[model samples]
Target: MADTHENAYDEFAEAYAAMNETGSWNAHYERPATLALAGEVAGLRVLDAGCGPGILTQELTRRGATVTGVDASEQMLGLARRRLGGSATFARADLGKPLPFADASFDLVTASLVMHYIEDWSVPLGEFRRVLTRDGRLVFSTHHPTMDFHISGADDYFATYQFDDEWFHGDIVMKMRFWHRPLRAMTRALGEAGFGIDVIDEPDPEESVRESEPRAWESLSTKPAFLFFRAFPRYSA
Candidate 1:
């Protein structure tokens, strides 16, 4: 099911990029969190896993990081290379499989707006830990379980369960699998994946977001639309 959704993205990469450039489609929520988690990327070896159109990759490069962006969609990578120029390298790879990089290769790794589609996130989280240098950080964001539940027409936001939803934006249609995990589940997943949580931020909506999409912004400000986390590889003395 996940693979089907991924392949669908590969087919609609162009349309996706076009819509995303406007900062609509939850861009205001995602971009700020990426920037906050990836502070001072200068001189860092960074990996942008599941990089959609390479916008975040370009941002990391602009901050002086040596960034490598990877995605399963060839079309997306092609668009990334075009927009990013030669500033960063872009590769095609699957998120469900072991990352193609060697152990201890990166100082930081990030995957923005990419986890909800994954059924078993622990696999890639463990793989990410394996590729990080000791003390390297992994920062990623995902749709808030509460937000997912609300958007999916679920009546109860406090329900402790998974909910399935389908999103349709014009011609692009895909199914989403959401895990409505409480904070405990998130921390436990990080611990089991050999990472220690450093920070978990649920930011308020910016003014622009508030003005542009008042209802969404208001809802998100009160209840987070997304969750961002910074985690570091666990060290044993």
Candidate 2:
């Protein structure tokens, strides 16, 4: 499944970034959430898992972290390398497989807008816990289930609930997954993966973005844009 998505991303690399730049897709969707969870990256050894095009990776570097970015798409990594220059390290990796790094290797791990594409979050979550230092943190953001309910297919928000049980975004040609689980499911998964939940935020879309973008405000304020979380590797029994 990850490979299928990687192949799709390889084909969409140019268009993906262009769409993001032109607002065909919302670039800011995950930015504020990721930054809020990261706090300060200064001097940290950061692992940017599923770092498509390195947008957040570059941001991490700017904040003084020594960052290494990994993604499945060679084309995406190519773009990341070009944009990031010598500022960070880049690697080609598939998230479905074991991450190719030693245990207790990183100060922090970040996965932004990437978890949804994965079928089993536990596999990589466990791997992330394994690679992180005892005190290290993992932060990530994913689609909100309610938002998924609202946007499934109906043009009107009120009309969408009839189609609730279906995989709302399943038919989306682009490779994506939607986890509409309640908060308890997420906390349980993290606990099963050896992580302790530190923070879970459902940010109000209006407040998250700069106030000048009225269109962004209107569209997002009506719905939750994302669910972000910060988790730490459990230190003791």
Candidate 3:
């Protein structure tokens, strides 16, 4: 399949960066949960996969992790590079293919809200497992399958399929495609990719959003939009 999300992110890089800076519930929710699930990142080596404008990458660096950011979009990486300056390294890599890093190169890998764009998880998930040290943790978030299935009005939730959606921020609008897979399918994918799941969380909204973005908080507090998991490599990645 074509990489539509990468193009959308690239075309709307500036707008997406501004939205990420807003600290909205959607923008901020998964990061905090990923960090908490990760325990401590200080002094750890981190790879922020699908880094996108470097939001999570900068945070990992600020929290004292030696960080590297990777994305397919050079426009998005440009924003990340400008925001982080020399503090973090940014690279462009397609997640559908093999990653460039050596095996066990990272102590922790955080992929925030990126996986839904990929239809088949085997290669990308294997790549994540490959770069992680034996005991290193991977924390990632994706569009909740249930929620997407509901919105898609699909007859079979178990069937993996792609759908189109629009993202709006002020005057910037972008169309994107996302793949939806059932939880069991994801569990099977993880198992097949040589990783053991640690935590599966449908966490509450981040507290900061309660006052700053009450509507988003109200919507997200009761209905989780994203699903998160922490896993470690079980066999060879």
Candidate 4:
């Protein structure tokens, strides 16, 4: 049986990829900020956890990093492999499960806008630390915890729960379920997993969006919906 996250994307691989290419807020906002945070990627061994459709994975390879892209949904991985060709490796692996890589396999790890699909962070964050060299950095973007109310209209700010919402892709609207955890919970998990927080950023939307999609720019600039992080393994990578 497929889990919530797997089912959501597996049924609509091309639709999701199309959104990431053009319509989704991630296309204009989240992805660009993630790449910006990961400056100067030439020759870095990169592990792109939850690398849906390989968009960010492709960019990392373009910047000279050798990358491995992993996703839980085989359908998404299919699209990713087709897009990435041999520029990067593609694998079907769940981020919430034990990663297939050996210890200290990468110089950089990135998970772009994928964590909220997970209900628990401890194991995955631990795996991320284990696969990274001592000097390796982890960069990621996730939905802002503050937007739970907007996305689900939940009254309690501190409660953690699941919510389902309809998102449109061209003429298709799909129902997606994801967990909403408080920021404190995420930070605690990161600390317990042996990562030291290097940066916490509430970044603005990409500058081009301001001119091309003013409504999105204003909405995001006034009340951002994504949070970014840079973390390093503290004890040992």
Could you estimate the TM-score for every candidate?
0.86, 0.82, 0.95, 0.95
The residue pairs in collision within model 1 are none
> Per-residue CA lDDT of candidate 3, range 61-109, in tens?
9889999999988899999999999899999998989999999999998
lDDT (C-alpha, whole model) for all candidates: 0.80, 0.75, 0.87, 0.87
Residue 196 in model 4: lDDT:
93
Candidate 1 CA-lDDT value: 0.80
Q: Give the poorly placed runs of model 2, Cα more than 4 Å off.
A: 1-6, 21-29, 153-182, 206-212
lDDT of 2 by residue, 70-165 (tens): 998898899999989989999998887898899999999999877755656678898999999987999998766567655565454332122222
Give the winner by TM-score: 1 or 3. 3
lDDT of 1 at 23: 52
What is the full ranking by lDDT, best candidate first?
A: 4, 3, 1, 2
lDDT of 1 by residue, 1-237 (tens): 354354766777777787666654446777777788788889999999988888888888888999999987788899999999999998888778888899999999999887766656688898899999997999998887767777677776654556666666677775545666555666787999989898998877567877898886767677767889999999878
* Shift in Å, residue 69, candidate 3: 0.7
Better of 1 and 4 by lDDT: 4
